[model samples]
Target: MSAREPSYFAKCACGKFCAELYGEPFLMGGANCYCNDCVAACYYCDDKARKEGKTNISMRCADYQGAGAAISCWLLDNLRITSGKDQLRGFKMSAKSPLCRTYTACCCTPMIYIGQKFAPRWRAFNLNCVTRASDGQPLKPTEMSNVMGDFALKEAWDQIPAGQPKYKMIPWGLFPKVLAVIFLPFLFPGSTVKVLEEDRAVPGMFIDAAMVTEVVSAETYVAAGVRVPKALLEDKKGK
Candidate 1:
C-alpha cells in the first residue's frame, strides 16, 4: 500500500541473509549511467559472484516508487545476517559522492548498495535483494548514473500500468500530455536537458541511454509524456 508500511525484505542467495525496510524507497525509477568506473565495477562484481556459484540473485521491493513516494527509513543498526557472511565483499568507489558501499557478502550474491549520504535519516537499498510474494514485475530501475552499457527503456515503460495516476493523483495517461504542453520550449533545444536510462547490471546507477528511440529526441519525448518501450532500450553491450 503506502511506502510507510513495512513491505520489503532483502535476502541473500542462500536465503540466510535478510534486511528489513524501515525507510521510504528513494529514486525508484529508471536511470542512465555513463561512468566507466561504474561499468567496470558492476561487471567485475557480477562475474565474480557467478563464478562463486551465485546466480539468479536479485533485490525485491514492495511497491514501485514510479507509482508513489519512496520508502524512507534509518538503517537498522542491529539487523542480522542469517547466513553467507564468509563470502561477503564490499567496495568503495567514490569518496565524494556518498558513504555508500556496495556489497556481495553472504553467498556471493549482490546484497545491498547502501550509503549514508541520505543519512541521519534515509537510506536507499537495492530493490533486487528484497523478497516478497509478487513476481517483481514492472521491475523499476531506481538509479542509472553508473551504467556504461546500452539499454532499452521502452520495454520498461510498457510494464507500467496505464490506468494508474501520476504521483498517485493526476491520471496516469494524461500526465505526460500535461508536462509536454507545460514545458514545450524546454523540450525543443537550447536547454541543458539530459535523458536517462537504467543499466540493469549496476544497482543505483543511471547511464545515458537516450539514443534507443527515433520517434523524437529523448528530451522532447520525455517532456511530451510519451512512454518509450523498454524493448527498444539495451543494456551495456557485454555481460
Candidate 2:
C-alpha cells in the first residue's frame, strides 16, 4: 500500500477516539465473529456505558439481546490511533487469555483486538468502530460467519439467517495467512508497514499489554456493578 492509499476511519461513538486504518483488509479477511468471547466483549463495553451514566451511548457493536457478533477485519501493520489514544484501555476475558480487546474509556466502544500470536505485527479492528472509508467507497463486506452454527449462543445462533456459509471456528487456512502477512515486510521492503521507534509511545497499541485488566469470571463484572451477558453465563454452565 502507498502512503496515499485510501484509509478507513474508526471512531468511537462519543467522537473521543479515532483510529486510521491504512491499507485494506488483508489475507485474514473480514467476518461476523460470534464466538462467546466476542459476545462477552460487547456486553462488557455496554455495561461500561451504563455504569458511566452514558446509557444512551452506542457501543457500535452487537448481535442480539444477550449475545453479540463483532464485524471485524484482521490487518497487518495498518493501524494508527489518531486521537483520544490516552483513553484507550485493554481487557482480557481471563488472565490466561491470549487476546486483548481495547475499549474507548470515554464511551465504552470496543475498537480493536490484538491476539498474542504476532504481537504488534497484526491487529483486528471491529468494523463497528469504523463509520467511514475515506476512499469514497463502502466499507468491506463481511466475507464469512465464524464460530457460529450448532455451537455457542443458543438464542442468537437461531437468529442468524440461513443459507450463508458458517464455520464452527476459524478455518485452518487463517494460520498460514497470518504467517504470510507477518513476513511480508521482509519480502517487500517498500511495503507500507510502519515500525514503531523505541522511544515512541502509541496508546491503544499492544505496547500497553502489561496494563491490561483481566476479567476472570462473571463475578468480576458483578463486583464492578456490571451485569454479565447471559451468553457468558451459559458458557460457564457448559464448561
Provide backbone clash counts, one per model: 56, 0
**Candidate 1 residue runs with Cα over 4 Å from true position:** 1-5, 22-24, 27-34, 56-88, 94-100, 117-120, 133-239
Cα RMSD (Å) per model? 14.8, 5.6
What are the models' TM-scores?
Answer: 0.40, 0.72
Model 2 clashes, total count:
0
Model 2: per-residue Cα lDDT over 1-239, one tens digit each: 64644377777778788777776665444566665566666667777777887632333234355344555564545666667878777787765455667777787777776553344466666666665464544365556544544345666666666885566666666767766677766777787456467313333454444555545477654542334557557768887
Which regions of candidate 2 fall more than 4 Å away from where they truly are?
Answer: 1-5, 55-63, 116-120, 135-142, 148-151, 172-175, 182-204, 208-210, 214-216, 220-239
lDDT of 1 by residue, 131-202 (tens): 432553433444322121232133323344565222323224444653563364456655422223322222
The TM-score, computed over Cα atoms with residue i paired to residue i, of candidate 2 is 0.72
State which candidate has the highest lDDT: 2
